[model samples]
Target: MSAPSRPADWDPRASQVLADPIAAYDHMRRTCPVAHSDYLHHSVFRHADVMGIVLDHHTYGNAASRHLSVPNGMDPPEHTAWRRMIEPYFDGARVAAFAPACREIAAALVGALPQQAPVELMSALAHPFAVQVQCAFMGWPQALHQPLLQWVQARNAATLSADPRALAAVATGFDSTIRHLLQERRDAGNAAPDDITTALLRETIHGRPLAEEEIVSILRNWTVGELGSIASSVGIIAWYLAAHPALQSRLRRKPTLLRAANDEILRIHAPLTCNRRVPTRDVTLGGRHIAAGERLTLVWAAANRDEAVFGDPDECRLDRDPALNLLYGAGIHACPGAALARLELEAVIAALLAATASIEPAGSRPTPAVYPAGGHRQVELLLRPAAGS
Candidate 1:
């Protein structure tokens, strides 16, 4: 292909798609599922198209960014090695063991919030819920929350060119933190209940102990992926529940609803819009030819809303089959921490619902989620006590 052809009318760089992208995703799925963008270097929007590339790892190599996602961007054998090193950290048993800690963190954070109304859900709830759990998992000190939060916020801002300096600060802090963690773990001989840091320090890569650079990449991926994605996702869930008080009450009444609620949230508000892939060679998908080195956008948000795969694609019904949701992503790059993320979300939601009588919109600041993804990210709300609730 000489140059990727974009749909004539749409401007991929426009902010509206990043403001409330579901409409755009809906449009793309129906009109140009296998569409390309002249500016975007050939993006893929349909569910099947993205899935084909994601599942067939050989044809579409990952390795997009070397620093943060390490193996998330790599292909098979190399990918498999890194994946194996961290797999034990995300296993069923690992999640099972983490349940208690997750619940404790949730209950503590929820219980500690002042009874004052109009709490900014980001600072008061979502941020804490995500950070505390991550800290607990990594065996890091809770005192690190403030600076860590700042670093993460700065990093996200940098990604959007919202704040270049902020991004630099985040990187510096992150690098320092990684160095400290590695040194601390090494000094302690890296014994663990089996978290990623512990697993890495003890394990070897390619028959050699992992170097500092490799370890830094692993930590960078963890911090970047966890901080924004989890925080943004938590805010999304809370905003949804806060709007639908009935659903909030339902979760409060039945703790078991936590898991399904998580699934529903993932389907409803997929925060990560499009993940990129580089075509290995000439490949035809949905009548579109993808040449080598062309960038393909895997519209995860679009796929979840696909009418062919999901009925009432625009609705947020919690009763849908959880397995069908592609919110975490698909194929090799599908989230390994999805189980852990769900557990954390479930615990926090259950606790918040159980404690508050009802959630009301105190106030929510409107900010667009990242693209080729969109939605409101910051939502402020009041958790009013339900009568006899």
Candidate 2:
């Protein structure tokens, strides 16, 4: 792939960008909609540009990663087969069946929070909720919770470092852990507990059983989405509510709106930052020529908040069209696990609101997470208990 001759438009790792990534991305959207940088290669910031890329998968391919990524990394016929196979795992029936367990977990976590006292929401509620709910969904033991949490932290650290060796090591470790779980299910035979993990063992593609590597890859992707993105989303939602008391009270009184409200809040402040795509042929985007085979980063954080698409990106309005929200993305690779994610987010947020009379920011200012992660890293809040309960 030929590198762009134009000088770097902005440093993604600059001190200012790291300190406030959302504001930095907003600035980039206005100044350099299509930016070239050594780190991301080329980034598409505007909504229209990103939509064009995702929709034209033939021109912009999803198979940008060096490693196998199941449906997320596959293109066309191959992606079609894998995507068809995985979609049913999160179909309405399965998500509905898991709702009771999800609510139970969410309520228990909320009940445990200290009333009328300062709490670090991420550690106290967000991370643990993500880990516990994920473990419950996969039928993994509670023992894996702490280990999985640690692994997520390590993975994020390695990603930020941009060290290939560290990335490889983290990948290998996660693969090993997943392979062990698969082996245990195989050993149990019909005696194995019925769960998503076991269900994947029985899945086949093109009339053949899924390869061990494929199974591991699927689980790895699901785990990352569940643990990392879900955790970040929880923090973001809670922080937003605490900062906006009127919206918080409105949501508390009318719980049915939580679904759309959660989607809009996450749209304003994205959880997953970007997804990768590579051009199959040379293409012009945002008046910039991107060479064939060059990498493209679709900045969801910037694109969803583009002024041309959503007026006043920061405004929390529920009337806006849902199709325009890029929170879960669009086109073929649009997050297959979106249904499950929505169910999980709504359950947790509903539980939090039902249990607390009000959620207010504490003394310490919340710390925003840097690149490779979205939302606040540390959010201190005071959760006041509801009357008589």
Candidate 3:
């Protein structure tokens, strides 16, 4: 257990933070680039500090969780091997092949939307799109979609409550679900459907088949990434476009810009809040002394918007240096599913723009999602259909 070395610098769970996290984080970055809080331990809010920590994996390790997290919770040598095995899963060919189905899912969901009426985009479009696309990609049964979504919600709630027992229960439940799927595949032998889930079953590391726990851990990480992060991203992008009619019109005019535009929009409003790291040895950061083995929180929502790195953090400039944007993260543990994520976001956004003449916000104000989640929890929008179709 790493205790706070000094008086706390901020409270992450304060009402102000819960209400508008980006604004709160912006304030923190400007006032206290590195802050200490009981909830988040030591948070690094600056881009330079965050970039340094991510790049130096040896000094700042990623084994932050007690449970197995596969590559997400691993450090090099072990992380390198797992990463090598995981990279091929998200390769260009695989992502490209999945593009059509992804787009199909997007188009179908968009078509189902009520045109020119108040629609809660999160529930109507974002959540379902994430669930359907993730299930389709993994070859999971449609029956599991609702259950999987419920599980994600439970997990997020448990995380916010910071209850160990609840967290463990949800974790066990998810592991059981994955185990059941794996068992079905095992029983079928060669008859199992050819999908990412089945392919993972045959994958080996160090010449031995991946352990059941390892596979479960990998799937769990992927599920959270898809269900939580991707879903939040869709809502954020839609809300941004709805709020900014000029940018929305520009994107609709130039469809080719959707890819970069999505990245920029997400950068301005991060869908994922923070990632964890623990220092391997004593290090001083932001003029504060952080003892070795203490917890470190990299606030991606803040770092990506650091004024030192990005002048006028809120401004979305397509011409900004891509390398400076930490949307997909950087270094060893950078999101392995980035390619797939990009494909899914672009397809869905393009589908929404093509199907809708314009997307405008409903009269009601959007509610920001609390910590452990990103983007708006409730975003009501009026999606007008195109003239012809």
Candidate 4:
């Protein structure tokens, strides 16, 4: 056996790719489904190939990160155990319980939007809504919202920079913030509120109590998912609707169709771009031979928009099979918080549509986000509130 050659198929961080990742990924899926680069190492862009990697965990390991990531970065049976414990949090009962709070948060934000004027949706609505919902869900103090938002920005910057030292520092900062909250709950003891954070304190693994680090890791993952994907998703869905008046009008009229409509819109413009996986054994995919131990980046943004699977990648059809969309990913490592994410997104979008008569792009065009981040950096829209209430 010989080691496969590592050639630069394309520069993932190139200016053109960063400028518009959705278009860049579309090109990659067609031209080089499986390409190699120094930055991402091996990038997988096709639908079927990515499905194969995620489904078969034995050949594709999830322990890509050196730090602990609970179930997300862990392989079974460890991953399985963590996943089981975490699933209950997003169970039907819990999700239903939080629906009222989520809707209230969404409604309040939408109501505050400037009517018939230019407003940056990300800052005014998306980011605040994301952080507020997360904080409410976890029973965290409202005071943490600003700090949490700041942390998300710093973490995203560190990831994009690809500086190992900077990434570590950012991780430590997040851990510290989480640790303080945990300590506060501990200090309060019986007086602490019976919330999710407090509930985690009572959980155990394999007959032993979970370590402080483990609890922090679990919450960190949830925080990142809520803050990043949920916020980005809001921007993408709103931006798409603003651009397409017909679809926007359709969702507003139907209202019940917001969930499927959201999934379809995000499919067209992904909120989270990629996820990492390492090969436990040598494998050949999409006509490219990848060596064992080499890192592979599953370009979800590309896979979800694959022409082979979606017919026309750009077309938005709510009736398309939901199984094909990789917005929350697939297989064992699929997003555990997907239910909660859907609830949050649906609440926000529904509120926006209900509160607004129309939403259209305002002043300058949206500034697209770069690698490691999807959706827009800044999305400005002029909103018109619905008649009466």
Return the TM-score for each candidate structure. Answer: 0.89, 0.97, 0.97, 0.96
For all predictions, the C-alpha RMSD in Å is 3.0, 1.6, 1.6, 1.9
Clashes of each: 5, 0, 0, 0
lDDT per residue, candidate 4, 1-389, as tens digits?
99666669899888898877788899989998999898899899999999999999999999998887887899988998888888999899999999999999999999888897899999899999999999999999999989988887787778777888988898889889999999999999999999999999989999888899999999999997789889999999998999999999888778888999999999989999999999999999988777788899999999999888999999999899999999999999999888899999999999999898899988666787767888988898999878995
Best-fitting candidate, scored by lDDT: 3
**Pairs clashing in candidate 3?**
none
103: Cα error in model 3, Å = 0.3
Native-to-model Cα distance after best TM-score fit, residue 83 in candidate 4, in Å: 1.0
Which ranges in model 3 have alpha carbons more than 4 Å from their true place? 1-5, 156-164
lDDT head-to-head 1 vs 3, winner: 3
Candidate 4 clash pair list: none
> Looking at candidate 2, what is the lDDT of residue 360?
93
What is candidate 1's local distance difference test score? 0.74
- Candidate 2: which stretches are off by over 4 Å? 1-6, 157-164
Which candidate model has the greater TM-score, 1 or 3?
A: 3
User: Candidate 2 on 1-389: residue-level lDDT in tens?
Assistant: 99446789999999899888899999999999999998888998999999988988899999999989988999998999999999998889989999999999999999999988899999889999999999998999899988888887787779778788998898888889899999999999999989999999998899999999999989998987789899999999999999999999999889989999999999999998999999999989889888899999999999999999998999999888999999998999999889989999999999999998999999666777767788888899999999988
lDDT of 4 at 261: 93
lDDT of 2 at 318: 85
Q: Report the candidate with higher TM-score, 2 versus 4.
A: 2
TM-score of 2: 0.97
